[model samples]
Target: MKIQEIREIIKLMDQSTLDEFVFEAEGTKLKLKKHNGETRPTVHTSAQPQEQPAAVVTPKTDAPKVEAAPAEPIEKQESTSSEASSSYKTITSPMVGTFYSSSSPEADSYVKVGDRVNADTIVCIVEAMKLFNEIEAEIEGEIAEIHVKDGQLVEYGQPLFSIK
Candidate 1:
């Protein structure tokens, strides 16, 4: 597989909620694991050419490898809950972007656990492209939990903050 193909697959994983991926061909095998950090940043290295590059072709694969894509973090513990009143509300993202807890790197988070919030209160920032969009709470409640972390890539309608 070409390097570009590998990068494309990685980008797809980051864009979606999917986590791990594996592919195996006759003798070539590929396994990708997403780390705990936010979306990967563009990395530049020395000894790289700065001129226009030619298009490369990738060969098709016929791998039958078993693949596992854990949606959530493997380190997160799961516990059963006696159904509450079912009165809790979920605040979802309005767009697909990088989720941020603060306006800048040096600023405090917009909202945190146990923080009292109401409608129209900015809860976080979802950066799409170069613009940082402020996400607001649509319901009144205390922040029960935050689903995504700072600099994390969030999908449209993804759960951001849970209210109760």
Candidate 2:
């Protein structure tokens, strides 16, 4: 793909909740990732031909750089779940894909906090390979929390919702 096309994809990813994106066509592959809330995304490209070297593209314009604060040692906090909180069960994503809280942008979410659900309840939709798959809440209880936002990319076994 052309650098301009890759730049456009980066722009779209920045607007969405996606942190990383991988695209492969023919024998070329492109991967982009954003880190530490940086405005510019890092790009990596690879070609199938073993002798062909990958290219790294950097923006031409000079941007102001802000120095990051010194890292501080993180202190671990003890888990303090009460009996009520301990009873909550998490509904995890069954596949790696984008999570949609509703069927469409104009539609209401399938489930929300304080909503009761059962095994047959369609909690959300996970889109993979352009196919939208309805995700069912296998546990019976009230939704304690919605762990993921709409259009967020989720991995297999990632917590999507909590029930109690």
Cα lDDT of model 2 by residue, 70-159, tens digit: 223223332243433667788887666999999999999999888999999999999876768798897899987787799999875688
Clashing pairs in 1: none
Score candidate 2 by lDDT. Answer: 0.69
Q: TM-score of predicted model 2?
A: 0.50
lDDT string, candidate 1, 50-164, tens digits: 2322222221234443433322322322213343236767888776699999999999999998999999899998887566778889789998778888999987568887788
How far is 23's C-alpha from truth in model 2 (Å)?
21
Error of 2 at 160 (Å): 0.3
Top-scoring candidate (lDDT): 2
- lDDT value, residue 121 of candidate 1: 95
Scored against the true structure, residue 51 in model 1 reaches a CA lDDT of 39
- Which regions of candidate 2 deviate over 4 angstroms? 1-84
For all candidates in order, the CA lDDT equals 0.65, 0.69
